[model samples]
Target: MTNMMIYNELTAICGENNVFIDEPMSHHTLTKIGGKADVFVTPQTYEQVADVVRLNANYHLPFMLLGNGSNMIVKDGGVRGLVMYMSHLSSVRVEGTQLTAQGGAGIIHAAQIALEHSLTGLEFACGIPGSVGGAMVMNAGAYGGEVKDVIDHVKAVTPTGDLVILNKEDLALDYRTSIIGKKHYIVLEAVFKLEKGDAAEIKEKMADLTYRRESKQPLEYPSVGSVFKRPPGYFAGKLIQDSGLQGKGVGGAEVSTKHAGFIVNKNNATAADYIATIDMVRETVKQTFGVELELEAKIVGEDLTETAD
Candidate 1:
């Protein structure tokens, strides 16, 4: 189909207001760097999301799902087909000790809801900057708690746009990884099993975690928090610090002085600059410690040079 046809179809499926052409990916990612997306769609409902997925499948168009873009870095060349932004689908509900949150609901917001209901299990997630779906995809966690520990089940749409309910066992959640991405499942909702606890205690715990995060992380700058996954027997931040990589980077992108694990957009950094900084850190660490540091942040889209070629 032509670009016009695709736009019209997308508008028909969603609405004209929900679709955009040549949308800036920098506006959608945490790093505040990237080019543009050929098409971007904000689906307000689960059915709309499913339909958008099906449409992309039918047209053989490439697509990527976006939550809060908390852990993603889009490249300078931007993305080709569709970019589905799910933030509008956010909704959280509580019943007894079970908290059900829509895919787009902020994980932090869900934690707050749990606290409001005197739920304790989600206290650790109070500082995680991700959407429920994104959290489920990577089993996001902090302060010695993981999403897998509290998630009971998830409702997601498969790559074929068919919905499926997956129990915790089927999710295959591990340290910063899950089957959700491998299976190309777009999360619709998640059910968390939390324990009832004293609201005061929960609030206190959340406050403590928040303080730790704000104090340690480079929250003032734009960044894809925690650049590398922790290697066995060593923390990524400690390793980066040991390598003396902190306070250094390419262009406006720099390894955060506050936390070595973070690569911040200290100035108006380009995606290339950010990626180059990541590479420099990775190479430096590999040479220094003989440890291959795997990335925690997801890199997407294409580079500007590639687009020009």
Candidate 2:
């Protein structure tokens, strides 16, 4: 399978501990479904990531970046070549009201960091499960607050391995997108400027938001949170509910009867099953509203062979 050659190359670059062969994506992904990545590499620093990129260029090996796996789905057939997980890059530092987060830092963790610094702007992310890199790339927002609103600048490695800093204005963040993820830019870190607030008040607000999220969302189930973006004036969940798609699905991947927005893997659902349910929901929503609801979650990798079962 040319596995040895691939392993040797990876081990030569990042050593044995950092490289994993056929690592299961099910455990890593939020939905807890899918096959394995051919090779999974978790680099601890931006320099290591850059080095990996350079190695990929040398070997002409295929590769892709991964964050928290919240807003994404890898098909049941699994991903080919190198899958670089950003989790190892976690670091969050607050200097006064300004915060700097390593790309792989969870938004929830970043929110906590902000709270520890008595910062108020990151309260919206107190409940988010995505990484700072993914959040920045997608211009992630919730409850009237957005990453774009607070992010002052970002540091990233380009496709050609050039490190650069892009200011907030340069990111061109809007809606659910930014230049980084689109342009194939690899985010290394992000700097956010927040406001000083009472630490007690910040903690109280975060707690309130967390409670509200737990009460409203399907927190117990394994699923990608918020399957679709808000479509202009209408909420995606509301539209699906109004269309009578609540609790409907292709297999074990059922639309949450609790929320109607989330497609949860209630049983041992396959990524194929999850995707089939996603398709059904989209089609039904399109037919009913003629709105052609867009998926917020990123769907990638090869299609499944035994998809029906």
Quick one: best lDDT, which candidate?
1
Across 217-246, the per-residue lDDT of candidate 1 in tens digits comes to 999999998888989999999999999998
> In model 1, what are the clashing residue pairs, if there are any?
none
Error of 2 at 201 (Å): 1.5
lDDT of 2 by residue, 68-122 (tens): 9888888988888888899889899988789999999999999998988889899
In candidate 1, stretches whose alpha carbon ends up further than 4 angstroms from where it belongs are none
- Residue 209 lDDT (model 2): 90
TM-score for all predictions? 0.98, 0.96
User: Using TM-score as the measure, which candidate wins?
Assistant: 1
- TM-score computed on alpha carbons, candidate 1: 0.98
- Judge candidate 2 against the unseen true structure and give its global Cα lDDT, from 0 to 1: 0.88
